[model samples]
Target chain A: MDINRLERVSDFQWKILPQGKMQVPAIIFASENLIKEMDDKVYEQVTNVAMLPGIVNASYAMPDAHWGYGFPIGGVAAFDPQQGGVISAGGVGFDISCGVRTLHTGLKPEQVIEVQDELANMLYYKIPAGVGSTGLINLNNHEMNEMLTGGARWAVEQGYGLFKDLERIEEQGCIEGAEPDQVSDHAKKRQKHEMGTLGSGNHYLEVQRVVEIFDHEIAQTFGIKLNDIKVSIHCGSRGLGHQIGTEFLKKMLVNAKEYGINLPDRELACAPIHSNLGKNYLGAMRAAINCALANREIVTHLTREAFEQIFPGIELKLLYDVSHNICKPEQHLINGVSQELYVHRKGATRAYGPGHPSLPQDFQNSGQPVLIGGTMDTASYILAGTRESMQLAYGSACHGAGRCMSRRQATRQWQGNKLIQELAHQGIQIRSPSPRGVAEEAPGAYKDVSTVVEAADQAGLARMVAKLEPMICIKG
Target chain B: MPQPRWEHFEHQADIGIRGYGTDPATAFEQAALALTGIVTGLELVKDSEMTEITCEETELELLFVDWLNALIYQMAIKKMLFSRFKINISNGILTALAWGENVDITRHQPAVEIKGATYTELGVFQTENEWVAQCVVDV
Candidate 1:
């Protein structure tokens, strides 16, 4: 982006003063080099978010900010209902509650090297993937309602996972106030067979090995160790979520005018928090969140089954599960007064600091374990939330190395079958539904993850802990 | 008369689909062709089955989003890839027929799955000689 438009706040902080319709300033956290690599659209979209009604503080962009619908992908904004805040479907993104969950594999890389192909193939066979991939667990009408309202807890009750896993997940695996009736039958029908499946495009389940540790103490608290093997699942609510977003965004689009909302960009279609439309969207959005939590939990079950078949007596414990795309009501202090606000994180993770009641009891002394996914070929990182970040970024952190190249461009430059052979040479095994999908997700298509994480740490958005390199990547 | 055509444009993150025709209805049809192009080559998907789609909106732009998303919803629920689209717009309502076959991984070889169409870069207008409809699709 053009540095000329922004004033440098610090080495890692850049600010754009309120202009035109902007109700507040726009701030970005990134290294100078990362900033330069960003598209100018980041400035436009971040400023657009700032212009939204009742946006608290500044419209902040994480280090991995990229141009996305409505708000930028790494955009973080909170709206206060008391201040006539608005709820935007576009801001939450199409993949509702799309997030990452890491599991402790308790095995070494060398141990898996011998059986890597088998493991990858088994996972590919077991985990339903791709555009229309569906799981074997079909949901009846009642079961569908239970899944929507119950979330991962419902899945666990159905023997998909253990009860012990819920505590480590956001909202204890289910967000309250999900109104199953608000979700459309079309959305539900699309999800009936899609439960537990990983949808296509930029989604994956990867086996990774911790290659480096930045903060030993924090890494220890997160149960991460150097050279330790971990499995990370990257996906979302799938067809149901997409249908909800599509339906709601269109609803909000035409209704925005009814609420007297003057949208600078049509994609930023939204309704005031107190509006009936807003309430319905929230109800449905929460249900989608639950669906995602449940889907990931079931996939975790499948992964554990795969692991058990290969390494008997192995345990895959949930380290932490956090959603990057969501809007949740959170309490934070503003000018010495604690107030509840709805925070929207699109391609941004919540990184609550230590001592926050939300953190699991084991992690109270530490912070929320923020899982940052890398591209298929790069090193992902684990970061711990800090009080500084909570205050600075509304408990938000960058989600991943944002895409630097368009999928179309990536496909033009690389071929999927060719790239797979090349990654195999580097000892990274890849399994997917389509080879063309693999080509579109070429590793170089994304920004350098470590650099983004380093910038996030330097900016006090999240403190880096450990780095993970993918040993096997199952793409969808 | 303008020939129906579809092309892809580069958005920073998502793919932009643009279509052109001599008339507004044909432009919408070509837009569907652009949406079809995102997954796989049109030749790979044949017109073996037909699905009907209808959308209603007061404005042209919102109707365009509704039309595409309705097709997306059907595609997901039906698990099909459409190759040919027959669209007609009257007043503000759109009724159409989309034809294609079931997904064959080996034959179709779809590159990526489109989640939904977005209002970003959305346009529906008549030019000096033809009509155009375009929008960005989330994949």
Candidate 2:
């Protein structure tokens, strides 16, 4: 992240030219000040990703880049399987397919403000969260495989939601080639009781209201009217995903050398795309993605049920659901030739531009809606993917305001109870099982989300559509 | 016998868990203590029940991760928080017992749920008189 080492391409775009073992340059979409604030490890990790075989263009970092295990958080990389490309487990992180899903409730902020406290309490009690939190739906062996293979479709089949909701979800609810047999019994066992539950650490459900509109046309297309109430759930495949990552990372670590991979960091454990290990990982990872899709669908159902109980005659429609942490096969034009590439986006959200074939027909004109969730105390945003961004950062953008300080530092600086009182004074109702978790995730512990978005917009990673302010947040 | 001790080290994201003792078994026990502390203070957990655990791995470092993950699995499946841990490593197999209670939400104000131990910064080795078990955990 050192400015001297990077050549500024524009005000927001910077390039670290290839050096040492790097096979390609590394690009960062951020302002100089933000780059300075970034941990130096970001530079090291991003460059290391460039060294991976068959990487295309560069290992790019979104505006919110920060140091992570193998690839920096917000890192984006694409690899060509035909060119001996590889798949990395660390690049996907432990929380497989961790993403955000926004639900639009046909109600205004004024309608919910009067009963904010009641709603918050109700959601807190209804939603299973924190460590050892179990959900109402328990999955036996048959249901486990079904959920893994069927994804959101499975949830809908179980009467969790309506069929119309599937269109807005990624992969139309399930990705094919999810070999459940590739997923271990240990992983399946851990997920048996975790379906429909929100795991702890940065996962939350926020009740937000559209506060400002940046692009009226796009905002309308995304079903946003000024002051309209919305609920966003941020989570992923819980225990099952974690167990898969754990099992695969260990396997890849022990076999990296066998694949002729000269690991700059052992945490970047990987195998060649054609290798049996890589195929197995893809099968399991795809299943995990389906698991996350199903988990979010069930949680959305729970949210709808809670809303119906509190305020009848309400409709909650899906706005968009996109994963920030995942690796999926994609087609991108490289050197004026369209080629199949495996795109890995860890801590980065995919922002499909307008007219992209992958986008749903409703969003083809306005582009995909990239939902960004900030801390409970700050404003999040809804951004539209642009054609420029698809080419700029591989159709990816920052997921959230990346953490600026360590959790330990945040806990030491602020008391949780006091932080809650302060947020309450600002009119953001907070409900969490652990006050200590609140302190660790204090808004001040993160970079300014507004600044992060501005950098993304200026760099053409994604275009801003609207801003949202939190009214109620259920944290676990 | 040396007293078991555990402390935290700062990672950019997540947290580093470290345990020190005069022997490997004590270090493993203390490392488990640090893992529990990440969720909530170990002092808050009562020694109400004991759970037995056993795991095997060829590598010592892997064995360390296996041990912690086993405890994590037990914590999730049983809905308990453990404070006191006893570990014995013999014949490349680790057998342990953890004592605690079903979590009292009012008492154990856990900050974050530990997902699993990671290979990042993983270490298990003896240095002179002190033995250390250390690794970064994903939360």
Candidate 3:
């Protein structure tokens, strides 16, 4: 809590010196105002993350930093395997690959205004939302395994999407090394019926209209024409990812102890990169990542279906899909040399610069598209990864306007029914089974995403592309 | 008090849920229901089958976590969709038997997945008039 010891390098960057058991210093990127509002525990969580083995550089917290399970939700850190880097479930959070994916509706605002209600209703009916919602695809063990391995590619093969759309997705819609066998049957079961359904609690499908274009040429290239309608889907691997993180963390705790790993925070429980537990977890986690990609892909398919019903000839092309959770192997220039490090982005997203090999050819000049979801009633922004992100935060940026208050606190503070009505009055149609869900996700409960995105852009992590405002939202 | 509706707690990474009843048997059933809500959305399992599972841990806290975790583990590992669970915990021990069946993909009825329970702010104690066990699951 005594963050006074932190050294401020600039208006948005601060560093916590290594002390006690800390293996590395903790770096935080936030405007002075945002830092002032942050919970004292963010400092503790980031420092705890610093103590974990194989941590490279400084443990960095985004402007949206807040206290969370093991790693702060807005925390980003990297570990080197040869240096004994480890993977922690707390680092991934409960919702694995829980990030935002954007789809471009070729229509301008005028096109949607006339049939907005019908479009919203059609989307609401086509895409299942709310707690316990299920999608059209029901797969058995073999099929689920294939989906786990294939991800969006599988969905496309099933005619759920156009193959060209895959190029715009992160990892081309799949993270390799997915082992379905490593994924528990419970995870498959949980995913079987839940495919394509938007699970509730902060998860949402938003139809937005681009209000501002920051970089004209880049925005145009990314198809972010002003007043264009873009649908943003925010969710993740759901129960499957949750299961993987849960099972692995328990095993990792034991593994950590057996390996004589000393953790500053038990929530930062982890396992050595080369260990069986670590390998299995990574495999299963990747499978869950695939599940999430496929889930979003299927959801996009449903969205397109709904849109087609409303506007027969329009095309809803994918803008980009990015995951904020989970760890990945990436090449980064550290200390003047390039090395492969495992980057664990808990509530962080990978913001690869313009020339990364992993990026699609079209985006090579634009950098990867980073989608940040705002509250249902606020504005979401699309940003481009920057070279500064590579130098500052290991190619990581904020995921969204992170929660400032707990769901319980939000529920106690507001009434969901009223919140929904207010949103309706604001020209946003909301759909969910529980009013409590609405209250729990009230915009007031989170930091303004535009502010967070602005901080990120200023801090040299990413560059703004466009700002999107929601017109309709499907919440689970 | 309307059977207390639902009792909830956020134990760091895990969220705990408890449903109450006049009797312990109903309390146990409701507790399972509450646990189901914690990991995955309960509504996903529209139809379930009779399946049983048992697990033991050193402490009741661990027992409870492991108990719920076992059910979730089965759900993930077996692809089974269970709706009923019978649990008994006493003397630093826990015995949980869960019921759910294999999901029929043709039916497209999906179940949510809760990975495991965490010890973060875990509790299972009796209040003056009623028994209470609260814990969080890392879902």
Candidate 4:
């Protein structure tokens, strides 16, 4: 990116003043080196997002910002309906509600290492993953509509998980305003056999060990300890979300002219929030969000079952579950007055600060747990929302180590078998259906995760709590 | 004349696919090949079964997206991998026949699942004697 085009606000902040058709300024949160390493498209996409209707405050990008389809990944923006605010399908991304969830497996690293190979194999055998993978449970039309509207809460009702797990999840595992009728039958058909399956490309189920603690108090609040075993599942709404996003992006583009909105990029197709098109998209999008929630909940159940097979009667408690790609109606202070705004976070996680009424009672003082995933061989970090983050980027933070190299480049540079062997030598075991998939997800293909987390911490987007390294990975 | 073929381009997070041919229909077919190539090796998939696909759009680029997305929908619902595509576009309506077999995980070693076709870098244009269709696909 061209540093000359931006005004340096701080060591970790850069600003682009509104110009041309831009309705608001563009702000990026990243360290100097991180900002310099960002693709030029990030600048173009962020600035393009600034020109959208009724965008509140400024267009903000997280520390891990990178070039994406429409809005830059790690982009954050809020809009007000009173000002002719618009809702964009591209702003939420194709993988709607794609996020990370961590679980506490009250066991030590040594205990896991004893049966590491067996456990990895069991997890691979039990959890449905990769292309064409289908779960044992198939949803009929009635069940599909119920699952779409009820979310994880419905999963628990179907004997997939415990009711208590809902408290740790965003929106208590079921987001309201999800109109299943708005979702197309074609979308529902795509998801019929896909429930609980981890869709491929950048999705995985990993067993990790906490290696270091950055903030002891916060770590304690999050129930973390050195050598403690944890499992993280990263996926989303699968085919249903993709269908919704694909169908809606085209619709938004066709109706953009009718709404009197000019699109700088066709991918940034949007409609007025108060319009019928926008309302229908929101209803359908929310249904996809619930699908993802239910998907993760069922996977959690499968993970627990796999663990019980190895360590009879072991308990795996839910830590926190939050989606990065979503648009939600949230309340925030604007000009010292609290108002509801529709916030879109594409590849950006919501980091609600301490004392927020939305948080679980246990985390009222410690803030929301912001889970950041890493590459198969890299270290993932646990961060907590900070009060300052609310004022920074609407309490938003980076989701992962944004890819620095393309998949083609990564595959050309590294062999999947060789990469797997290298990771195994480093005490990490990988179970993947395709060696080519492993090559595409090579650790070197992504930016250094720790650097991104450090930038987030320094920028006050989130406070680092603990760091974890992978012990085993079940790649999709 | 250069042979009709497909190639993959580099996008930061996703993959860009471009197809080249003497006409728009062939270019669209090659683009479908590129889309299938993203998931598995094209040669590994066999042309054992055929499915007809139809979609319409007034604009060329959107028609191209609809074409690819229709194939994606077929791949997901049918659990198939397509290696061959025959495209015919007339008056903004695309009617095509795609041939492939059910997904054989062990045989094909599929890499990723393509989510959808996006408008990013989307275009269908003519240059000199050949038509080129290109777009970035989320995988």
lDDT of candidate 4 at residue A265, scale 0 to 100: 95
- Report the C-alpha lDDT of model 3 over B1-139, residue by residue, as the tens digit: 3453456664322356665654443454576678655433566665446666666556544555566667666665565666666666565455566766565533422222344566454555656566555555543
Alpha carbon lDDT of residue A412, candidate 2?
A: 97
User: Best candidate, lDDT-wise?
Assistant: 4
- The sequence of per-residue lDDT tens digits that candidate 2 reaches over residues A394-443 is 89999999999888898999988899989999899988888999998899
Worst 10-residue lDDT window for candidate 1 chain B reads B104-113
- Over B1-139, each residue of candidate 4 has an lDDT whose tens digit, in order, gives 7789999999999999999998999999999999988888899999999999999988998999999999999999999999998999899999999999999889988999999999999999999889999999999
Reference-based lDDT, residue A277, model 2: 99
Worst 10 residues of 3 chain A by lDDT: A128-137
TM-score of chain B of each: 0.97, 0.96, 0.68, 0.98
The CAPRI class of candidate 4 is high
Model 3, C-alpha of A444: deviation from truth (Å): 1.1
Candidate 1 local accuracy as lDDT?
0.92
Instruction: State candidate 1's DockQ.
Output: 0.77
Per-residue C-alpha lDDT of model 1 across residues A1-476, encoded as one tens digit per residue: 88878899999999999989999999999999999999999999999999988899989999999999989999999999999899999999899999999999888988989899999998888898886677989999999999999999999999999899999999999999999999999999989899888888888999999999989988887888888999999999988899999999989988888898888898898989889999999999999999999999999999999888888889999999999999999998888899888899999999999999988899888889999999888988999999998799899999999999998898899999999999999999999878889988899899999899999999998889999999999988
For model 3, residues A63-169, the per-residue Cα lDDT tens digits are: 77777777888899999999989888778866888878898888888777788788888988898775445678889888899999999999899988889888888
Residue lDDT tens for model 1, B1-139: 6678989898767799998988767888888888888888888899999999998887987888888899988888888999988888899989999999898877877777789999988999998899999999999
Off by over 4 Å in 4: none
Query: What's the i-RMS for candidate 2 in angstroms?
Result: 1.2
Error of model 1, residue A130, in angstroms: 0.6
